[model samples]
Target: MDRQTRSLLAHADHPIAAPLDDDSVGRLLTRAVVRDDARVLDLGCGSAAWLIRALGQRPGVTAAGVDVSAEALERARRAAEEAGVDGRLTLHRGEAAAFEAPHPFEAVLSVGATHAFGGLLPTLDAALRHLAPGGTVLVGDAYWEREPSRWARETLGEYEDLAGTVEKVTAEGWTPVYAHLSTRHELDDYEWNWTGSLSRWALDHPEHPDSAEALRAAARHRDEWLHGYRESFGFVCMALRRTTDT
Candidate 1:
């Protein structure tokens, strides 16, 4: 996508950038068993909603957010300032795998941005690499809700079944500690809010060079969801921790 479309998608009012609502955010945070002043990293953090919430809930905690979109990071900076956590947050603009820090974090998170690391299993590896020993890694990922036809499967690209997902994580030496599957309502909200934001942007920027393209892209995504894979897919935030010897 072009910078204009990316800017539109990263609009300040675009709701939660992760594929989750407020409730799921709370659950994922709780699963981390955060401690006061813990250091956290959010891969593909979008506009820092999760980090802001974490800072609010845990006094003195510090966070770092990495995303490739300058537009998204711009919004994130504003959000951190508005939340009074600007001083405690560091924002990086880059791919998640290339994000380097002074040290590993107590918790690492990625939501709906696993594609940056290529796919689900690769994302797991990337997140864990930056995780402190026994630290938590919270991943928001999707699985087939039901079997899909060949056409639908190809359209949605590749995904593991839930059982296979769990198995993959376990095989990677992480133990699943908490899991929250998104409801249909939450999923619908994420999809609609994203497209709705783009529509609003296109309407507001009718004279801009990219306006038509943005509008067309938004419409295409809406149609794809409604007619193609909406019913056959599901999302979850699974919290995992490195397995340690007893």
Candidate 2:
């Protein structure tokens, strides 16, 4: 399936689009958005779900999100309006790595989007460019909970174990102020929702042009998750601050 189609199906059931429960998301946002009247930026902010939630919880916060998907940005715009935070949110359609803002934000978020910048450290580099001094970054990415099989490594790319993952960021001059390792329930929930949402869409719209493709894609993804990476793959989200002056 195409990227847009995959994204639409993947996020149909879960707006956060990661293996994180609502409570976890709320806690992470609370840690990341520490400053009063904070300005926040989300790179590769898919549908801007995080920003919408943050803006809703904290009226003094303003946010901007950049993503390459016009469709996703439209969804974000509509969602923000529904939440009555459209005035406090801005959406930009562009490559997040290439996006530039006029002013630095107090908090930068790039959850589950390190792939857009090639890897975790590069994503942090991008966030650093747009971050104010003493600002925090909220980043999330996959890790290896155990030594992965060759197929799993090839499928998901190589990642360090949780400790090594944290070491990498700290070595790059960021300290993890708070972190969350997704529980087994959260991981299974995400995969189930991802596959189920797509499968349901296909079942509901059997006559649609992409129905067959969507069904096949969903089945393939479900199989891959159950057999390919279920035992070893893990996800971590961290609220990080610079360890030194940039």
All models, RMSD in angstroms: 2.0, 0.8
lDDT tens string, model 1, 1-246? 576345446344545665677878887897884778789999988777888889888877899999887877887799788988899999998888888777989899987878788888889888877888778988888898888667678977678888887898888788889998888998888888878888888899899887788888889888988888888888878888878721
Candidate 2 clashing pairs, residues 3+ apart or interchain: none
All candidates: TM-score: 0.93, 0.98
After superposition, candidate 1 runs with Cα above 4 Å error: 1-4, 7-12
Q: What would the per-residue lDDT of candidate 2 be over residues 1-246, giving only the tens digit for each residue?
A: 588757777788898989999999999999999976999999999899999999988999999999998889999999999999999999999999999899999999999999999999999999999999999999999999999999999979979999999999999999999999999999999999999999999999999998999999989999999899999999999999999857
Candidate 2 positional error at 136, Å: 0.2
- Give lDDT: candidate 1, residue 80: 85
- Candidate 1: Cα lDDT at 170: 89
lDDT agreement with native, every candidate: 0.81, 0.93
- Please give the lDDT score at residue 60 for candidate 1: 77
Best by the TM-score measure:
2
Candidate 1 Cα lDDT to native: 0.81
lDDT of 2 at 205: 91
